[model samples]
Target chain A: MRDRVELLRDMVLVRQFEERCARLYQEAKIRGFVHLYVGEEAVAAAVMGVLQPRDRAVATYRDHGHALLKGVSPEAVMAEMYGRVDGCSGGRGGSMHLFDVAHGLYGGHGIVGGGLPIAVGLALADKLQARDRVTVCFFGEGAVAEGEFHECLNLAALWSLPVVFCCENNLYAMGTALERSEADTDLSVRAATYGLAAWSVDGMDVDAVTHTAQRAVEMARGGAPCFVECRTYRFRAHSMYDPELYRDRAEVERWRERDPIDLHRTRLEASGDLEPGAFDAMRAGVDAAIDRAVAFAESSGLEPLDQLTRHVYAAGPEAGR
Target chain B: MSRVTCRDAMGRAIRRALLEDDRVFLMGEDVGRYGGCFGVSKGLYDEFGPERIRDTPLSESAFVGAGIGAAIAGMRPIVEIMTCNFSLLALDQILNNAATLRHMSGGQIGVPLVIRMTTGGGRQLAAQHSHSLEGWYAHIPGLTVLTPATVEDFAGMLGPALADPDPVLIFEHGGLYNVDAELPDEDPAVDINKAAVRRAGQDISLLTYGGSLPKCMAAADELAASGIEAEVIDLRVLRPLDDEAIVTTVSRTHRAVVVDEGWRSGGIGAEISARIMEQAFWELDAPVARVATAEVPLPYPKHLEDAALPSVPAIVGAAKELLGRG
Candidate 1:
């Protein structure tokens, strides 16, 4: 068992990274659509704890937390968000399309529900190759309605693929609430309909998300893919540009009171696993990391127009062959 | 020596592919115990078992994406859609994901997946089931399209397709499932990226593939009787189209006729004709002619269905027009 100090540090790091991204978005340093993974740090930090290095993960637009926790360099991810050649996707994909193949991070897909099948495919590959790797796919409540989601679940259940479908029920698919969108609000029950085991975990509690995801990931690696619905809420607006007119401010404030980062801090203090001085030190370290990532992104160069069509076709001098 | 149909040749090719690589597997509706909708995958389930000859739910997009994923993971996956028409439902996975993954990943990943599907109309399967969209797919850069018209093409293309580094889409004509011919025991291995001259001649070049190849061959025979001596070229590979072969043949013949069962406008025939005009314009003695299916949803009536698609008479008529014999 990891000391509460390390778990608290992980949560703090993810929270700081997301807070920095929100600042960058406001400052206009990172262009294109930016969806910050704030208020949902527990989902990534906790789930990533038990993910083996060989395992793969796919996330949606709200994916910075997932990427950072997956061990992709903060500098590389921020550089990608800034559209620099040194970025993971080489600036081809902006904030919403960050890809780090080296870390087995498939991407931060822009399209809702599009990444579900892709995650299943990755898991299917692991099963076919007889590899002991499991793939964890993360999506939002908004994705439950898409045909791609249901279709992939059917195949995954039918073949018993090694995948853990983690639905971060942030309660909104853009501006629409889960109740307004899905006929069945309980997303876990839908997975059960497909013949796979399903469960719901408190997304705001890091330990809860971690423990539940560990069991699901184990089942997936053991030969049957599993589905986990993390009943969480996003305190921030859907995107940097969203006016957030769909939901009430009181609701956001209520969820914010149960913020996962603050909850972890309190738990650490109560358990005598962390002193106030140590917590302050961890925040300072996180702040320094964020500063360095911002500097790296600022110094990184932009791709030239001559290479606009470079990766569009898989052949020639520009194909990065 | 053994006699086999195009469908039988495809089955043998699949069996050989399965034997050659344990990674090679078939997955689709009725491809296993049902022996495929057209029986093209007949007897595969019994030999390879359900593991290799797996049957999938009616989720074209998901399964096709899975095939792409499997291909990238170092396995050879052959996904079959019931027909070319239904592939539209899987277009997101096929075009956006499978076709673009190689380029989008900047060549870090290449999908060696093969998607086989039925195409063309003659069975009166109605509007929804019968149509050819190979021409639209040929326009894409990353994918290679093939239409195996001859039994040799059916048998020869699979091995090479399985070896190619990129994705390959093979359109097996539903109308030609029962086509039978004497296939030589000695395998005449061929490339999947080149066109083949089915018959050699000098007066005119008749270009076609899939269901229209036999019609072009019949037209060639009739034109030969009339002393036109038409050369027929079967385009086994659709995309990265064998421009050299078509240009060289048209340059020799100096006149050309294209036969396609797709619609006339913006069809594969239209693209072929445009290419001939651009590359071999000076070699041509007259304007190129074409025989394409009529522009309409294929109706259920026998005569309406027959009238909606290209036939032997249509190809013969187009050839005569190009020869100024009409």
Candidate 2:
């Protein structure tokens, strides 16, 4: 069995990080759109846990969780949120576009369904180069409405690209309910039409997500695309600016009762996987990391004004020749 | 030197790219078995096989985006959008992903992708297939737009475009595909950074690019017969415009006429005119003149379509009018 404490630690870290980010935003520290991954931590923790270092990942705008799970240092990501030069994207990309190319994190694409075709291309390169690597692309249920979703799915299946499309179905596209936006709310069923091996899992359960993600990655490694629909929920507003007029407060409380962190902790306690005071110790450690990250971001310098347009293109042979 | 059509020259260039780099591949609809919509990749499929020469479905967004991703993942992909008209369907991927990825990622990624599409009109293909919209693409910042007018450029431009560390769009004029000219045995090393002066003169400068280049050249010949020596400068690179070449020609000639296949209002010719006004206004003997297509969708009938696009005689008339000799 996987380490339940470690999994819980990861989920708690994401929870604490996002909570701290919200406080920072209120304190006039972090700017730009901050789409917190509050209730959907299990999806990233489990899915990213299965990915090897050589494997690549493409995430959506709500990507702080994915970036952390993919091994992007909390300090770098927090610095990025603060728009500091020490940020993962060199303070160029704000909250939505967290990119760590060295770790094979392709991007935190802001556009819905934009990262799918890119994941297919990354898989295409790996396939052509005879590399045994998988590219995991994460998108939300809302992306199903985009034309690129259909197009990318068809191409991945037609070309047999090695990609694991993880659709985190958080039940709402901003405020529109899944049933209202989609004709049929079954995302995995639609993906199956493209000849991909598709399924749905309980995203609230980390064990279920881990098991399904492992199988999906294995299938993708064998030269076939797979889709996983993680039926999850987002407890917070879509972004900090959202007033959340669409959903009722009663429904939020209902889903919050099934919080993935509390559920995972309860399961771990019943299974004797957690020692007494372990959860508190884990929280303390995570809080310490978040404190260090905030300090780093606070002390970090802003990028110089003169270098505003430096990274538009890489410095290549065409420069200063 | 050997005489060849622009079609053959481009085909040969693609063949050379495939032979030179194992990472270079061609992907588009009808690029393989159908030999491309304009036969620009006629023999590449048979020669390079299905792996390198991939024939994609009509999903422009998917394939183009895939090409961008492939470029990021260490492959040099030349994506063909059958015509500039159809590229609208793939604009999101082109403008948002391909163009912005490098800056978005803080230089962690560079899309070394080459997108080739046929631009301009002369064969009465109607509104959709006939408009020259390379100017629309030139409006974007992150792209390098190349319009190759000569057979030499057709044979030479792809190498440099592929070698560049950014996204490049090559707009090949549909009218010039069948036009034949002598090309060097070895591919000429042409730079995509500077404009080339087609003809030298001391009178009015006739500046143009793509399908309009030949018309301007013919217009220069017509002007020469009437004792008006007109200079011609082909703007090979449209995005990072060769302002130096434009200024040099206008400074010498003391007058300019920008000939473009697109409409006059806010077209590339307008940008060129504005540039001249900013840099070479003092050198002008008269206000700069522009010869552009009428502001209308290209018509289906040959006569109407011909009237809608910039013609050689129209260019000549504009030059004569600018020189006060019309």
Candidate 3:
């Protein structure tokens, strides 16, 4: 197990990194649908912490945190959001569609439940090829309503595919709350009916998520799927365009009380897992890294207009055109 | 040396693909013990067993997306959707993930996946299983759509499709599955890029593919008896269509007719007719004639089904009209 201090750093980096992204969006540096991962850092951080470099990770649109945790250079991710040629996706996938195959991060799938089947496939390939890598797919509670969620769960279990479905039940699918969307609000319980190891954990606690994810990853590596419901919250509105009309201010304030980064910091500081002055030094390091990322994004060039048709097919002059 | 059904040729192609590459697998609903819905994969399950030849649940979105994923993760997967009609259930995955993954990922990924589905109408399977929709797939930039019309194309296209890194869709007309042809002494040379001149003449050029191929051939035979040599061009590849073959044949014959089993409005026939207008307009002695399926959903009755589809009479009528002999 990684020490609480490192987990603490991962969560802090996500919190501050996305805070910068929000400011960038406001300043018009980043355009398109920007979904901030304000309160859901622990889910991505801890899950990514448990995954080996060989294991794959697939995430949804609010995916900056996952990209960061999966080892995509903060520079490349920020550049991608900036829609520059230097972006990880060569500026083809804006904020909603980041991809870094080398780090085992499949993509930032824009569709609600699109990544689930792809995750099943990645695990299917691994299982067939006799590799023990586990594929961890992250989606929101909104996706539970999609038929793909049910189909993928059944297929993965039926095939004993090595995949871990981590549902970040942030209680909303865009603006629809979990209760409004799901017939039964307990997402993991519905998942368990598919005959896999299913459970929900406090997504607000970094240590708890880390512990749960460790077991889930191992369970998947043993040659069947596992399901984890990280009951977290997105402190911000769904997107930059959202007006914040659906949820109560009081409810948002209440979930803010259990902020994942702050809660983890307090626990580590009291447990002496974090040394004196370590908190300040860690935040400083995160700021410097993010500063470099921002600088790279600002300095990067946009892809040329003529190159637009490139990569549509794998090559051959007749393909993409 | 012998004659073989197009379906058997297709099965042999898939079986050979599985044997040549360890990374190849055939997956779809009823593809294993059920022996494939169309019987194209009849003996493959017995030969390759359950590991390489796997049966999937009836969820098209999941299994198709799984095939796309497996392709991206470095495997050549041959996914068989029962028919083009059911392919609609998996269209989101096909268009979104399989087709879009390559360009959207900015050259970081390529889906070396081949999806095969039976298409066209002659059987009374009615509305659900009879419509031809490969035209819709050909409209996408990231996909390669091939409508194989001959036993050679059926036996030949899969190998190259699996070897290519892009997503390719092979639409085998359901009506032509049982059509028989002499097995070539050696495997007839074929590719996924060009059209073939099935029969040559000078009076008019007959453009067609898939189930429409035989109808056009019969139309040519009928025209030949009347002393009109009608050129027959098999438009095997639909996506990046062989425009040169179309222009060359039309440029020579000075009259053209497009035959398609898909619907008339916005169908591939329309696209081909438009291409003729664009590239070989001055060469045309008259407006290009189009022979496409009627716009109505196909009915279950055999007579109505045949009536709704392009037939030899329709092709012959269109060809004669193009030559001012209507």
Error of 2 at A18 (Å): 0.8
Query: Model 2, A102-149: lDDT tens per residue?
Result: 888988999999999899899999998899999999999999999989
lDDT for each residue of candidate 3 in B1-326, tens digit (9 for 90 to 100)? 67989999889888888888999999999999988998999988889999889999999999999998898888889999999999999988999899898777888988999999989888899998899998888888889999999988988898888888899999999878898888865556577788999999999999999988988989999999989999999999898899999999999999998999999999888999999999989998998989999999999998998899999998888888777788
Q: Each model's TM-score?
A: 0.94, 0.98, 0.98
For residues A265-287, write the lDDT of model 3, one tens digit per residue. Answer: 99888988888899999999999
- Model 1, runs deviating above 4 Å: A1-4, A22-28, A301-321
Scoring model 3 with DockQ, what do you get?
0.79
Candidate 2: regions farther than 4 A off: A315-321
Q: Which candidate would rank higher by TM-score, 1 or 3?
A: 3
- Candidate 1 versus the native: TM-score? 0.94
Q: What DockQ results do all the predictions give, each relative to the true complex?
A: 0.41, 0.60, 0.79
What C-alpha lDDT do the candidate models reach, one value each?
0.84, 0.92, 0.91
B256, model 2: CA deviation in Å? 1.0
Give the residue spans of candidate 3 off by over 4 A.
Answer: none
- Given candidate 3, what's the lDDT at residue A113? 96
User: Candidate 3 at B188: error in angstroms?
Assistant: 3.4
Maximum-DockQ candidate:
3
